[model samples]
Target: MMDDFLTVIALIISLNAVICLYRAAVGPTTQDRVLGVNIVGTKALVVVVLVTFIQTESFFLDVALVYALLLFVVTVAVSRYLEAEGWKEVA
Candidate 1:
């Protein structure tokens, strides 16, 4: 019963993550798109962990961890570049 519940929740997360991706693709500003991507990435981590639990394979969570780390690095890099370009967070 718990397994089924987890699966259902994972599916919901997947659907929401897809919407986040669509938003990322069509967002008006780079920051808006980046926010979308960040949210999607967070959802991906949860999805991956759920999959790992469903499959009884703990190793899948390691992949999610690495993905999160990479996402952080990419976000930081983009933020630095934007800062250098004089993009202000005045909004």
Candidate 2:
């Protein structure tokens, strides 16, 4: 019963990720695309955690944590670069 619920949740997350991919592909601006990518990463992280529970493997949780950290760092770096570039354009 619990496994079935987790499977459904994971499937929903995967569907949302696909929608995010669409947004990333044709987002109106760079910021929109970045936001989409960030959201997709978040969804991926959730899916990973769900998988950990479904499979009863603790190692996947660790992998999810590492992936979350990487996602955070990458999003910050990209946003900072975009901000600097935007400032340059304004100046």
Minimal lDDT window, size 10, model 1: 82-91
In candidate 2, list every pair of residues with a backbone clash: none
Model 1, runs deviating above 4 Å: 86-91
Model 2: per-residue Cα lDDT over 1-85, one tens digit each: 9999999999998998998899888887888889999999999999999999999999999999999999999999999898774
Candidates in order have lDDT scores of 0.88, 0.92
Query: Against the true structure, what is every candidate's RMSD?
Result: 3.5, 3.1
* Candidate 2 segments whose C-alpha is farther than 4 A from its true place: 86-91
Q: Best candidate, lDDT-wise?
A: 2
